[model samples]
Target: MILRRALWEGLLSLVEDAEDVPWILLGDYNAVIDNSEVCGRAADTSASMTEFRDFVTAAGLVHLPFKGCPYTWHNSSEGSRSLWKRLDRVLVNEAWLGAWPQSSYLSALPRTSDHSPLVVLGIVGAQEAKPFRFDNFLARQASFLQSVASVWRHPIHGTLMYGVVCKLKNLKSVFRSKRKEKGDLASNVRQAKEFLATAQALHEQHKEDIFLVLVKCCRMVYCAAVKMENMMLHQRAKLSWLKHGDQSSKVFFRKINSRRARQRVYQIYNSEGECLTEMHKVTDEFISVFQTLLGGVRRRRTIDLSWLRSDANYVLSTGEGECLILPVTEEEIKEAFFDISEESAPGPDGYTSLFYKAAWPVIGRDVCEAVKEFFVSGRLLKQINATTLTLIPKVQMPSQVSDYRPISCCNVIYKAITKVMVKRLQQVLHLIVDQSQNAFVPEIIADNIY
Candidate 1:
């Protein structure tokens, strides 16, 4: 028992080595944290469980949520003497959780072994796709709405989604022109400052009304130029915590370069165990691995949910169920867009929530129509369903594809649709979810559960 306690302490010490960086610790510790994890005759393990729980608390780790076989280890004994326990686990610190917020894992039942096999499933990594990054800085400009309005005004003859997609494509050029007109952000800032300085000098030399007015105008231009440049840096850096004007240009540059370096997957081991270092081979490996993983049994049994009604404290009424299925309203769509953070990552369309909000007046009717068509027809345009898979490195020197995390960056339109549906779900959540189930229930927290 003393030696077991030492194991827990040793693991905790290893976590300490990572400091504040994102880190994960996964393996079979031969320990269980809860009594519910055990089945059949077993010796008292409360001491071991407490020590393991303590170690987890000390390290500030959350159990990486997993699906599949719950009891990972079974003592192969039959009938009354059978024993089963979830001995394997994947624990990650808060920093790791923050880094890959939607990350999880999978545990498969053992075919020829005593313990289940674990698979780290952090979104699984991105597929190699053509780059099309829509700069948020472009959306913030004065003529930005005008540029969007110009293309969006012309109606394309096809699916509602097709029209939107085409308009977005055309706007790329409009935006390109706008960006060119605005010129290089760094150069713009420098020139604006120079102009401001010159104006101030001329005003100082001659105390005339015209010179004073010119000086004030130049000062405004300089400030605006600096603000635009800062916005560009902030968007690219993806450092949300960094303040807007904390003299963070150098920091932003460093962060962007670092991210670019980590995203490149130069090598991967294929299904045949052959190592491939070429970029094309690596991309093909990602595609093959994901296809196999996602292709599951098409034949499935229909779940009997009638039993849920009996177990639940309360169930949704007929009216509540009907309301949930009702077609979404334009007001609801607008609300969803407004609810999302403007800085939230853009999908394949390269436009964030801010674009919709700014161009809402001009595009609201068409936007609402495009969203409404989905509910009415029960079909989605392929363009609307398009997603960009982004790969983020999980280790200092990643060797396998699993060493990278997968992040699905869906388009803004798709998110808006989901957001509206989620809002509807929230209305009936309390009625359907039992009070005992605290997590994910709106306004209910699991503070009492320790």
Candidate 2:
């Protein structure tokens, strides 16, 4: 099944449809081009090899030079384990070949895998070594003076020694003064001019040949010193980058880990159906922890408290199908519904539905019961206040609501039922009123305020 011709053709078609790119295809071919390409004894008419060779030719690909490690595959049969074939190859497209005229492809000896790895190198415009030049050097005063002194003492064997020595002494003094101020190209040039003038004077008083010799000697010393300085500068820069390599690596991995972690969280939060139950089970602890983090989720700054009842209606939409509840507004169901639709894989139900079909009716009933309880409790509280009028004529109201005991066992029942019912009411009020959004107690009171 793995070696079927259709599978090979399908793979090739996939590559052909990819975005235009300069690609170098590399991997074990598992088939030979010719009898010579195979290492172990083989039959001349191997069907797989014949198909592979034809495919390469059809694709207009050329095998590159295989050097150093010739055979790419080996036999693992215990009886006669031997090197067995060169089936691996690297095939580059025309664009790649055009870009790298000098490229060479080769196969390496197999290591862990039965198939050897194919490698490519020396693709056109490969880097070449450049000869060092004196002009590229840079140095400070101290080094420049030292180089001058060495040249003077050495005298290049046969060059004029007397003039070179006089130039060296003048340059040494100039460098010492320049070093005190600061060393730079401007200062170096100034020192060179002064030394040249002194040498010219000495030559005029002595011999013309000596003047020319001293001029040449000074220029050569300056060039050598400058080159040495540049080399040192280059080394310092490279060393700095090498020292910070670990820091750069840490930054790279940090970004990758952060991105992957956020993606996982989003995937969980946006899932639905049985997956949502799983997501809640897995991420509820994290959400609870996040809730502890102050200001993690922001409340809308400007809430439309005036239009809350109307806005709430827009949010509550009727369910459409088996998974959907009938009474809840369509928009209210969208959140749960859409969440399930976007996961990489379907939820536990193996279907992508926005709302949990079986669960929606239950959720809808809960919302309706809660809203009704809020109004009922609010009405009961008003009735109790009216009844207190005759009995409280000689009595004074308590200083605080907490000081008042529940009227009776029935009063306690009202409080318990109202408290449980207000949870959604608190959420709804929070969404509508800007002031009440972060204040849960106000919403709880508002739910029963009527």
Candidate 3:
């Protein structure tokens, strides 16, 4: 306890003497932030945790969120004697937080020691163009509906599908403009507080009717500004505060940073055993790996299905065959749109089911027509089918591009169309599929014969 106090005083002294520069003090500080940070034993309120907390508060430090095991150190004991505590942490001040908001701390599994290893990931560079998403908070704005309607109602010359695409594209720009016009929530909150302070002072001096009214109005605006700030924080945290009680803004901000860090690929090794750290080099390596895998020439083998004719059980009935090529209807298209998940990640075109559902009144007819045209012409729009390929790591600390699996994110329109076709096929799938082939069939047993 004496050593902990001395260390806390030393940290405070350092913070006071050092300039306001970005710095991260991480590692085993032999202290837990709160009771929740410890397990297997009741936390002692009278312990040195308060001293550490006070030190952190005085230093204006923020704790970065960690991924993986919650506890960093564990006691090697059996039964009730076993204990775990998060003695290691990555703390940063306001300057550090501002400089690298996307930085993260990863708690790796303990290998030769009882304490888990901590890995601090630094921000790499400016992110790519993020796929556009509809912010639910924006729905609360008074001008939101008007803005969307104004942009979507504009006439566009072309085919129905083309017109819908044009209008959505135009609306995207309008939304972007409005987002900018809303300004920074932090700045707005500060200004609102200043206005409220001035109004309160005036009301105190004069105690007149107009001053009183001004103070009340200012108070309302200030409260709204604070609420908006909380809303923004909630969105960034990507967690519903209603379900899980209120989480500190600092904790939410750190979670955002941790998420970004986990998704980021900083470096990778090529097949030649050469490590590539530069952003462009790593990107080119990934491209080369994918190209070799996906762009390779292949010989197509022809399979005769004459044997299938000999087996009448494998053949589709006349009615079933006819149903396969049935025309897609507007109702089916609308159902497909509504069936898709609103929160699913967007593709390269930056559109989700939520956006379509929200603007359905204005763009539904054209969107339906566009989808129907694909069936008529047997050709899909390139933009609509364009996908964003993301790489998911197959193992911890993956070094090679091959160690990651590539997943494609297709646009919502394409997904909906495919979903409808799949639903139709599923209805007749059991009829033609052999009983022995239980792979794609639902509720089928294929026990090993060997």
Candidate 4:
């Protein structure tokens, strides 16, 4: 037990000192994760298992999913004395999993030994279809707006949410088409500028109407393309300085490249201390880890609320209570929708606040109706509430999943609804909440200072 603890400590120290690279620590851990991992025995729910669990959690290790036989080790004894346990397996950290998302682990049958030999396979170079993401720069194009209006105006029979989803899907196709038509913006800008310069020179020498008009049109196209490219870089970089006239695409591009490199994960260790490079195995490891985390034992403990009743100062006024549960209104909904920043990132729906603000005349009624329906039914479509969770690294060269903070990007519709509810709550919150707790309450901090 002392030797095992020393080994565990050493492994952790190594991980702490190692560079932020993909790591997999696999082989005979000689420990079963849970009761399911052992057979022909009641299972050891003891201090050893507790220490093993703590080691895994503290080390930020993720167990890889095994294919074929679950039990990798077995005692060669009679039925009564026989024992089987998953002692040999694979484990990896988040950095490794990120590097090889599709890696897989396979447990090969033991030929002569009690332990099974494991093989890790990397991801095959298979092309996957990219998901749809709305480009803010697209909004700058007049034809893009026309295309959106045309598709959105088409009638669809369903719930407000369903109709909105369908219209957005159709608009995706339109945007794809528009993207193809636009070709490459960088190339377009360069070619246009070249043509404009030549045409201007010709017009200056010959004083020809055709050359002058050509120069004017080409110059306008070039400027528009440059502006669109700048907007795209601005959106992608998300730098505060970029918002205020710092329009250096080269600087922004460099920052974007550095960020991507930092985020990319490339290697990991498996059981038996073997390093895995296969993409499939890495992917399997991550899936297994998350499933275990999200589907683990649920222990509910009852908490005593008796102490809260002793505090008489927490009572709310009759008017304040009424305001808390008040029905949402269209005016409040509109205010919430407009309250969101136009530059705020869009959700999975691929519709941004800018799109809604620009095309409010055509889509406002449907959006308003959708929000009202949600309030009335007290339910919303799954897609509307669906959020994309992005991991932001909290430290430089983070090796574990815990080192990154998960931020959920919810749909604009969801944000609008929540914003309105928050505004309504703000009016009554100050009256009910204690003055010491001044997080969302307006002027509470200043009042306390005075």
lDDT against the true structure, each candidate: 0.78, 0.43, 0.76, 0.74
Candidate 1 least-lDDT 10 residues: 257-266
Query: TM-score: which candidate is best?
Result: 3
Native-to-model Cα distance after best TM-score fit, residue 197 in candidate 1, in Å? 2.6
For residues 326-428, write the lDDT of model 2, one tens digit per residue: 2434344333343332112221112112112322343333323333444444433322112110111121212221222322212211332334444435444
- TM-scores for candidates 1 onward, in order: 0.66, 0.26, 0.67, 0.65
Task: Rank candidates by lDDT, best first.
Answer: 1, 3, 4, 2
Better by lDDT, candidate 4 or 3: 3
Q: Candidate 3, 351: how far from true, in Å?
A: 2.1
Instruction: Tally clashing residue pairs in candidate 1.
Output: 1
Using TM-score as the yardstick, the better of models 1 and 3 is: 3
Candidate 4 on 1-450: residue-level lDDT in tens? 778788789988887676267778988987776777788845766776888888876666666544557789988876877889888878776566657755658788999999999998675577788677677778777675677779888989988878887787888888777767878766777787798888889999999899889888988887887887777777766675566335545555545544554565444444345554566775565556555755656586665557665774676678777877777777888888888886677787767777777667777888888888888888788888788766677864344445556676888889999998888878877766776776558765776675
Stretches of candidate 1 off by over 4 Å are 1-130, 204-210, 271-273, 296-315, 446-450
lDDT of 1 by residue, 1-450 (tens): 888888878877887887469888888988898888888798447888888888877776777766567789999999989999989988876667657755667788798999999998765445556456666677777777777777888979998867777887887777667767877887788899999999989999998899999999999998888888888888887788877777645566545544553454546777678888556788898987776866656676676688876786877789989999888889999998888886678888787787788789888888888888888887898788888777777864466778778789888889999999899999888677665665677557754377
Better of 1 and 4 by lDDT: 1
Best-to-worst order by TM-score is 3, 1, 4, 2
Clashing residue pairs, backbone N/CA/C < 3 A, model 1:
125-406
Instruction: Give the local distance difference test score of model 3.
Output: 0.76
Between candidates 1 and 2, the TM-score winner: 1
Pick by lDDT: which candidate is best? 1
The window of 10 residues in a row where model 4 has the poorest summed lDDT is 264-273
